[model samples]
Target: MSMTITEKILAAHVDADEVRPGEIIDCRVDFVFANDITAPLAIQEFQKMDIPQVFDPDRVAFVFDHYVPSKDIASAQQCKITRDFVRAHDLPHFYDIGRSGIAHVLLAEEGFVGPGDVFVGADSHTCNQGALGAFATGVGSSDLAAAMALGRLWLRVPETVKYVLRGKLQPWVTGKDLILAIIGRIGVDGARYGAMEFAGEALAHLSMDERFSITNMAVEAGAKNGIMEPDDVTLAWFRPRARRSSAMYRSDPDANYADVRDIDASALETVVSVPSSPGNVVPVREVAGVKVDQCFIGTCTNGRIEDLRMAATVLAGRKVHAETRLLVIPATPRIYRQALEEGLIQIFLDAGGAISTSTCGPCIGGHMGVLAEGEVCVSTSSRNFIGRMGHRQSQVYLSNAGVAAASAVLGRLAHPDEVVRAPVPV
Candidate 1:
């Protein structure tokens, strides 16, 4: 039976000869994780099972990110609960305050997940790992608890929606723009309960970091998961940091797909998702000149070193608009350190942007850079739902780091070309 990459991985995990879409199967999970914001609930549920220990300490991870460096008493207490649980279980993958970063990005950086694995996390953006060809998805706390205890999960296989990318990308246009354009074309529920499989010759042009950005927002389009086949680019990035053996999987040429969409990458422009909905996307020029009070560049979606390099290139010799506040955060300690070594951090500071420790702080409105009511912000984070970053009335426009940096300088939503006539070397 021909199978898609998603089906191949799912079938392999379950020791099955074949699995069809909508089929319920019990599959072993290669990795399971939860962050500070979601781990406490999962821990409580796990305790109810009276399980003395996790299925495998090495395969479970706990990341303290959302409000780490605890913003308030409530958040501090939440971390305490998960920390205590991790210590009790002697979990080897516990990431605390100083070592913590966004769970999705941190897991990939540490090589906790890789090709042909089934990864489940309590965070929606867990789909980010799919860039490595993993069948990764987000689950509820109860489901997380079950997976942690049993090392297995029940999944209803999803039909696949294959997106074929052809042609080269334009300058300053990235995977973020591609995804926003996708969401805009096919509303938020377009791929609901289906696997979004990305393929085509254009994959060769997208870096691993950009691929991660694309998969990270799969949930925003209501997909069950988003995945790319394990190609040379994915292998080059995963092989060095891989902590365990990984199997590479690809879709059979004759595999069935629920739908197929072809995208012309060269035609894509730097795009942004307007306030309140990721599906509300348009070219950067469409919303240019709209006033912005803040600009944020960080999160699992676009916080990689590549993203910082792009932002730095634009902000290198310029100053941030005096009326606007720009906040720059690296997604992980390692990324933060690399930015410092590369002088990316200095360029941001010199441009009047504030740098933060690795955390999801401002992205979640937990602390740092929360917006005032009716204010406008241009962010590189994943979602921009109502009250996602602060006051319900505050508006957030989602864009790639370059666009966000350019917007910071113009004090409004602007195209990267509006600020940099010639790109500066980072």
Candidate 2:
């Protein structure tokens, strides 16, 4: 009996010859993380354990990102708690405002994550790191606290859903659009408690950033985790940054899949997830001309150098519509610096978009650019649950950076090409 990558990795870490889905097993973790939103509670739980010290302080990371610059008094206290824990433990991986961005992006850019490693974070999008071919997932405060204290956690192996995607994507179509399409096709809970393994020849055309975008949204479909098989592209990205090398894992030739599906990548179009749920997706053209009060082009799901460049290309010589506020946040501080060096920041500023520090800002309604009552926003952030970004009455439309940027220019939902092909000057 052959095993999928998720099974193989779990089995190896648990020192088992083989493992099957539904089997509960304890496995050591390569990395554990928590953010300002969840770390305070996890810290309280960790203190309750009465451990002299954490299992390995180096293996644990604390990032203050959810409400950077501190949204309010309560948020400030939460960040302070994380800082106190870091100082007490002398944890080198722990980071404060400037040194950290979003925990998921910071970990990857700063070399704390890589292929075949098991990573757990107190963030649902922690699975965002799985783009590098790792078995990463998000857990609750209690599970994260325990993992921090004991350096291990119990997991019920998830059966695999193999997506054998094949075809070249349309020019304006992106990983964000592709994932939204998947969510639309499957509904939100389509892959509940399952591991999503993306395979097939189409993987060859995807960049590491693109692959990360796809897996980062696996949680939207209720998957336990998402993974990609490592090849030369992964090794190239990891070779220069990995602190420790681990054996690369892949599914066996005859690995059994719980279900198999195929997506015609070439047929995908830029799409948006309407307010209230990520699964409520439709093509960009369907929603074109829908008025918007704001547009945001960054989040763990679509915030990176590549995403920044795409948005800049759209807004290079244009200005944001007077009625719409555009906010562009890079996912990590390093990406922030790179954007500045490339003059992307200037392009954003000149185009009337506000350039902010790398923080989850506004994505979680923490601060920076929250929507108001009855407001409509075209955002590139993940999750559009009612009240997810602001007041329950405010609406959020989720789409790629291209669509988000274009919407800001027109003050209405539209595709990137629509703006470019228009007759009037932006």
Top candidate (lDDT): 1
Candidate 2: deviation at residue 183, Å? 1.0
User: Stretches of candidate 2 above 4 Å error?
Assistant: 423-426
- State the weakest 10-residue window (summed lDDT) of model 2: 417-426
Clashes of 1: 0
lDDT values for all models: 0.93, 0.89
Pairs in steric clash, model 2: none
Clashing pairs in 1: none
List runs of model 1 lying over 4 Å from the truth: 422-426
> Candidate 2 on 310-340: residue-level lDDT in tens?
8888888899999999999998889999999
69, model 1: CA deviation in Å?
0.9
| Shift in Å, residue 143, candidate 2 | 0.4
